[model samples]
Target: MCGSGQLAVLLVLLLCALRDVAPLPDSGMLFPRESPSREVKELTGLWDFRADLSPSRDLGFQKAWYKSRLAETGPVIDMPVPASYNDITQDPMLRDFIGWVWYEREVVVPARWVADEGTRVVLRVGSAHYYSVVWVNGVKVTEHNGGHLPFEAEIGDLPQVHMMAADGRAAYEDVYTLPVGIRTVKVTSTQFLINNKPFYFHGVNKHEDSDIRGKGFDWPLIVKDFNLLKWLGANSFRTSHYPYAEEILQMCDRHGIVVIDECPGVGIKDIRSFRNASLAHHLVVMDELVRRDKNHPSVVMWSVANEPASEMPPAGLYFKTLITHTKTLDPTRPVTYVTCSNYARDKGAPYVDVLSVNSYFSWYHDPGHLELIPIQLNTQFENWYGKYQKPIIQSEYGADAVPGLHSDPPVMFTEEYQKLVLQGYHSVFDQKRKEYVIGELIWNFADFMTAQGVVRVVGNKKGIFSRQRQPKAGAFILKERYWRLANETGRLPPWTKYSCLL
Candidate 1:
């Protein structure tokens, strides 16, 4: 698995296992199809394309035609997308050319679509030759080395791009500009510093799951969640088990929210899953993930995996390779993996820059024993810190709360208990915030659908907000707590600090 946590939600990347399956389906293994919630704009008209006829076909690569107007690089003629350039040309050399052919076009996205913070605008190239490299506004977004595989790039709020006529305007064009918020993330011995100040990640773990679209992207749903995040005064969240859409990260970059971009490396529960082949594939996913999200300022940390079988004998070398490889890919940010494994036995713990621990205290360990929360939670922090001395984020906590379920004494699965569960964790966090504990993200930001299991209730009810984005009693509790923390911490917008000049 290559990436996981937004708001601390762990998106289980079951997609990684699909590579091992034979004859993958065209739907998931291929480019996205237009759904009711999604709209597809075709780029199949004539394009400015040219075939490099130099002695070395590497002329385009050397000159970097993708960076600027293809016409400026050389002569160009009309060539159609989704069709072979050889078929359109009358010249024999153009037809017979067995080298790199360059194609470029400027398609203006809809202003409404660009304005919508939730819409993730992806450009899908249906078919291309042997080796294909894609760039959005001159920045390389994706590289595919295989044939017949349709590739696409999710270019969120695409950078300003224009190749105009002599008059400085294309025949038709629309412009949308995005201002980036610049900030730095540092993980020291006892703190998670953003813009050189200790910041607490008092947020919720979130899932992309919803009632109608499921894991599919929906602009309305995404906007509602962003509204809830701001309403709750949460400054940061983990992508949970895997990386979320580029659109969400773009919102974070623009709005000054923090993120821990995780890979799809989940469910390595079996010892056999830690083999070299699996490790090789996992590295590729990280490569793709980093290329897509590396520039987003909101992404402060990179999570390599989530809850793998770290106690296994092979896990030591396996995680060492995985974590180190991710660090090498993007050294700008710290790297981590969510672990529910025992701290002493987890092979990957030593490699992570921060210890993101997932624990269910009173709910799972001693059902309804709220009093034990502080004791157990404190020990959890002390043990991990005593062993590693690294910063810690209570990446996952909180008990499932069935909305409106009542109990006088705060029983499990009730709203009261969920409120108390958070209260219990918060008490411990308040104690450790001054020490090595850097952040605390709840188990869920909202209740989400999951596979039917004994532990699930219709789905997971651990969300402070229901799956519909409506607040539970716990949401109000968190709103007050988070706002207080924000004020006490003097949380400023990320763009306010340009440098360390203070």
Candidate 2:
């Protein structure tokens, strides 16, 4: 295995090769097709709970009381997978525990699951809230930082097939697997690795809150969110500003979406939070995240900061060190930071495996100057390409929408505006595919609530879906474009049957 020093060397080599190297992979690499032969393990179920920081939380996830309490809980508390605490807790104290949560569930590996040596089971988290450490049947499988990014843990070593002991007791009492199955199995962090290659993350930023739910979400509702993005042709997703539920990540893994696991580090614009933020605290948060979701196969990158432009020098150094530390903890995937600096060349852009930039060009600038926006974007990409030689993913790019306002030929800001901007973006994207630019994810999948209050009708209606799960005209425009771009098949999948907006 490559050590930390080796990884650092690799990063340096990337920097050294920037100016002259051609692009790595073809931009035409389509969204990965589903694997019919693979069987996924579902870890969704009731989790035993306690919030007072009791010692029992540390007894590990296998304690009898914990299991019994979780199983016996009524209504199963309706804690949806791929959701957040914001959806569950109404208590003041519980509401702010955004960085920590203990999740427990019982899973039985079917007797036929490990029939083949190459088959494996994975426990994946779409996005962790802030920090998390995941344990499977008491085995520490994976952990991750970054609440918005996806992460997973490998449960291959865990028995895939289970049955009652010879005494016919608990269904999980005994486990069996082919001896060769162990060779392909592992217990590790879910750093992103697609087709055994490090895939650059490309997708939109997401928020957990909907104006309707006010932070509440159920499984069916959550699946709607996925369908909205999937049909729009997004292969990757970023849980902007906070950790999302594991339910989302599990779906992403099964559905073949790359995830950028993010931390709840946004909104640090205030000086007080910046000063109070400690590397140790951030490390603790990130450590938990890395521990819990590292085994997921869909998570491709770990993002530590977003829009830290205000703290340029110090924040830049902080991000570099954090990325370095992340590689130390788990080096399978890449590290990145989304910069709001608008400059084609960001201060810390060189440190990441992929360069991510957020630009409002045509949206905030001149919508009439649509042609010029892509040019400006390309110029910026060129500057970074000249310096980093790393794959570039337009992390954030989209205009705000009011829903139901699209024009046929497409106009800017109207439902047509999304289609217009996408048209411009794809125009440039196609041109640069040969230069190694990967792909683009529209800024958001759904309109969501933000504390910013800068919104007009509601807070940040950039999503293709309105805050109430209503499909906007932009959703349709985006869906057509996304499908054309990714070459996806038929209607929304099983998880997204209720909402076909994508």
Candidate 3:
């Protein structure tokens, strides 16, 4: 019924409305999974690598290195993919390199994937160093600036094929190669639940540390750690202070392990450090962490900071903003920050969904007085419950134990002392299990390297296992307690009494 110009104007208005209503592109990291129209190929293997040692150098993308033209620029060396370039070679320079290292590889997309219009091609890197930039066949695809989590690029169309030989000795040849997926993690007033069922975190706090790799993505070490966790009757773990390699999360997903993915916002003390610059970096880290690990079923919660200065008045606003932002990223999982602050008066306690506390009652507080653990823990838990009325997790609690030390009556650094310390915490944990206390993750799973200090022998000795991944005397004590707790907490079915031991 309208005139031509009026009709055209109406079309313009409709189009503008549609544009405003359209959903935004997903900014989250992608993990390849085989759907009806999707396929994946891992681009992990040998990659040409070099580290820039110049005091000043421009960005790699600004130099247009993603064009796969590094061979034309300077010298190149072969290095393994999914690895940190720091400790791969005998050269001390390469082992201690801290600057921008470049890695490049030739990849070929599958013809079948290119043929399907609905199919999407993505290149996924499990983990890299502090920063990484990727180019797919001379086209800049993605750049991620975090070392711990995975980053992916959606390569829409496969370019003309010109693949190099596998041994890195020849020219180009066309070959088909290409790439590459939550349970509901709910929290009630009294319990943590997965799919509406009560869940308990019988786990340890872990770091991606080892003898040689030094935070590098090592598959064998990952397998060993998971095996050790299973052997210890652990069903969960916190990525203690930073995001772990994606391969670790994938294995946890497949093995039915719960994860509390944490950020590297440790040692954030004082109001000056909690200002805009620090908070901005913290938010960026949170964005990357959520985007990368959002889809993993193993991840039940996101830990924003580890042992932050929560007693500071400014910390209240800092954590509140960060926690609120994390919730916006993924509203499904609970957001919490690990605090060593007193429950009766932590400035950050009101900001988190779960009250995560790191208590060292007997070890640090009363110093070898195991008798005070239960009483102290009980009072703290009661205070936290009364104040917050939220679920609580003993995010960290442990004692330092040297591997071979032994004392019958229990002395500090002795194996018997570690066992007794755990027994004391377990006694209190059992009593609080009936209430709102949902989890207790031991301070660490394995002994790890740390900055040298007067109090530290070699490193923090709180791990149930030694640095070599060998179990200490405390390991058996935890194994027994965890198995029993899992059974009593209904985490395992009646027929699965000793399944973790299997």
Candidate 4:
């Protein structure tokens, strides 16, 4: 109880304060250290999951599943992230029949490594089917609705929000995540905030029917598809009809590819039922998507339906309702629905942030109608502009090229023909139109898988590249055009023809 004793007490207090400030090195796991601030966390490990038919039913997930899945004596099953059940299940359920699927994975953060201001950690999810709710450690940090987009959540601070009690159960905000110094996070559609600012997106229409993976895909194949698109100057990509795997979105975040996430609810014909069912399903997916992907910077738009209700009047109402639902969940991004050529110019079409039209003037209309192509194409853009006066996107326009075919006299399959068509198309786009044509994304970057046996040139040659991901001579022309645009530092002479480069 003398001077030495008081000095010892002071020393102990100082050491405790220092421990708080400089956590042990092991705590580093709590704060993820990845480049670009948006690199997706590798959530591609084992996950305990079970399916539920009634999404509306009050089926408990936190207690039974988590306890059994995490039990020492319980069996450990692998649930790879960025993967779909149908792709792995030998006797998979039909796409429409899949209901609720519960997933349980343990999340951890070392005690010393709590996220400080400079090092913020986020868990990102690429896509979930219909709907999903994520829990970290043992607390629900996020909830999401849509399935086509990405979602994220921050889960670091624990003592301030929750603390371990004598009973050994962690508690916070009434819900719990996992129990490993782990902070729980949940994601929902309304929360997919981008840079704290709502983002408007533009990108290419993507279909996932590959010759290699068919409609089913794994993580590796997904990454390859993404890499191919990035090389072609694509900033954004759409899933077109179905919700893609979570890995695809994760790859986009890593490589800086913005995704326009869509759902699996394509070929939807019945609009009356769709109004109730599709709208609810789309919103749920949006909720999950925004919640999980909110932290990623690459996502910018939400597309609810693609070519819906092709020949139905209620299609208008369905699209209108879906857009409204999406905005309600997350207004930070614009909403769009891709319509067939016939309905794209419909006067009664609902309101949208951007006016998108899918036209194939150069294809199907008449191959040799070079002179008339511009007149017809420009009119479509003008018609949408005259009514909406909103930013217009010539969303889908590209021709198929046969592989191994080169230029001959009359040169139909040669690079010469490809360049000529591109030149004529750009000429039309170059004209001063009333509507603001912000950008144009061709229908695809490469040939995709089509099961209906409707593809040309042994596949959907509509892509500049083929299904093997090979350049079909036209790819060179595209690269040249992109290079010319990138190199235009000043008043460069009206860029020369792409054929000249060859």
**Per-model CA lDDT versus the true structure:** 0.74, 0.56, 0.74, 0.51
**What TM-scores do the predictions have?**
0.68, 0.60, 0.77, 0.58
Clash number for each model: 22, 52, 4, 42
Cα deviation in Å at residue 486, candidate 3?
Answer: 2.1
lDDT of 1 at 279: 80
Best by lDDT: 3
Task: Name the runs in model 1 displaced over 4 angstroms.
Answer: 1-150, 153-179, 492-502
Tens digits of per-residue lDDT, candidate 2, 71-140, equal 3422233444434444366665554442224444444455443333444545555444444555554445
Q: Please say which candidate is ahead in lDDT: 1 or 4.
A: 1
lDDT of 4 by residue, 125-196 (tens): 544544455655445555554444555566555223332222333322322232122112212222222444
Ordered from best to worst TM-score, the candidate numbers read: 3, 1, 2, 4
Evaluate candidate 3 by giving its C-alpha RMSD to the native, one decimal: 11.5
Q: Which candidate achieves the best TM-score against the true structure?
A: 3
> What local lDDT score does residue 110 receive in model 2, on the 0 to 100 scale?
57
After superposition, the stretches of candidate 2 with alpha carbons farther than 4 Å from their true spots are 1-193, 196-203, 270-277, 342-345, 366-368, 406-412, 452-454, 487-502
Give me the overall lDDT of model 4: 0.51
Write the residue-wise lDDT of candidate 1 on 99-142 in tens digits.
Answer: 66666776655543444555566666543444566766677766
Model 3 CA deviation exceeding 4 Å by range? 1-26, 34-39, 55-78, 90-97, 106-121, 135-141, 154-189, 195-197, 362-372, 407-410, 451-458, 493-501
Error of 2 at 72 (Å): 26
